[model samples]
Target: MLTLYVDAAREPNTGLSAAGAVLIHQKAQQQFKSPVFQSLDNHAAEFQGLIWALEQLTDHQDILTVYSDSKLLIEALHKHYAKHYQDQVDRILFLLASHRLVFSQWLPEKDNLGAHNLALQALKNRQTND
Candidate 1:
């Protein structure tokens, strides 16, 4: 199965935020990370990471699972129907359904450490580049 770990961070005093995603395919032992600029709140950053991950996926019908540390994001996704942030939520759900993706929430920063660090790093990099 392919597993994806995702996280997001917002620079202090800066409206800019970044989403980082790492896809790990156990069998192949491969990992991929996508970092993107996001213009939203923390929750929105989390959703953007998921969306970016889905967009990077090459297969729409693979046994893929996403691991996120955001409980709110996970709960939003688990709902029977999309709620506020409906446009973003709908797009994520649509990708999940279209790609037959499975998602689960993981607490404890360790589980999502890599992605979390990457997100912070990406944010730092963005700041430096600016």
Candidate 2:
């Protein structure tokens, strides 16, 4: 089974956003963070972070679980949601469907601090670049 913890952060004033993910595969762990491709709200950044992590998959893991602090991401994956972000949601679903088993769970901010800090660092990197 593979576990991924993902998070995102956005600066309200700059609209600068970032996404991060911590991937645990077998006995190894990996971390990733990047500035969001587009200027998006925090919710979108969360979705994007998960997407980024899913895309990083190489060997197909039979069971994959994703942990996120974004309620919107969890709820949207569980049920039908607004059309505004249907495409992004669809992309995530498509990726999950490729795996033999997939699970999405919500984690508290405290429990997800590692990913959260990575996201903040991504935002800071963007700030430095600009």
Candidate 3:
């Protein structure tokens, strides 16, 4: 079974945000860190990260179980709705449509350390450069 873990981080003072994701299947693994060029909130960053992660798997044709610590992202995917983030939610849905099966599940923050750290590093790198 293929599993994905994703997270996003925002520098509160600067509103610098980025997305991180990890995909794993047995021995194969991939990590991603995408900077959200636009200054978005953490919730929005999560969606951007998800979209980036899904884009990397456009050729993948199997069940994918995704885990994230953002409740907004998980719930939006489950119900297919979001108020302020409706566009992001819609984009995520569009991305999912290409996959055979994808489950957006939630986990505790501590459990999503891989993606969390990636997101933090991404944000830090962006903040440092720009």
Candidate 4:
């Protein structure tokens, strides 16, 4: 089973945002973090992390389980429960259906520190580079 942990971060003053993900697949692990273009809000940034993680999979039969700290992202994906970012929510659901998406759990923020830190780092990097 492939397990992915995803998170997002934003700079309040600059409105800069980043998405991060840690993927555990087979015996290997992959990490990704990047600044989001167009400076999306927290919800869109967080959902983009999951979308980016899902896009990393090349196999259609791969079983994927996702862990996130964002309740909005989880509920949006699982329950179709987002009013504003319905497009992102629908896109994530489509990706989930393409893969063997089994579990989408909401973990405590502390439990998702790896991805969280990565997101912060990405945001910082974007600031520094710009």
Q: What's the C-alpha lDDT at position 52 in model 2?
A: 81
Location of the lowest summed lDDT over 10 successive residues in candidate 4: 34-43
Stretches of candidate 3 off by over 4 Å are none
Candidate ranking under lDDT, highest first, comes to 3, 2, 4, 1
User: Which 10 residues in a row give candidate 2 its minimum summed lDDT?
Assistant: 34-43
Model 2 lDDT per residue over 1-130, tens place? 8888999888887777888888898779988987556655778777877888788787564798889989888989888463567888999988888788888899899999889999899888888888
| TM-score of model 4 (CA atoms) | 0.90
Per-residue lDDT, model 4, residue 38, is 44
* CA lDDT, candidate 4, residue 85: 83
Per-residue CA lDDT of candidate 4, range 5-44, in tens?
9998888676678878888878788888864544457777
lDDT by residue (1-130, candidate 1, tens digit) is: 6787888887656657776777776555434445547555777777877787788777677677878888877777777344656778888887878655576666766788877887888788878987
The order of the candidates by TM-score, greatest first, is 2, 3, 4, 1
State each candidate's clash count.
Answer: 0, 0, 0, 0
User: What alpha-carbon RMSD in Å does predicted model 3 have with respect to the real structure?
Assistant: 1.5
Q: Model-by-model lDDT, in order?
A: 0.73, 0.83, 0.83, 0.81
Clashing pairs in 1: none
lDDT of 3 by residue, 32-62 (tens): 8885555567777778888888887745777
* TM-score attained by model 2: 0.90
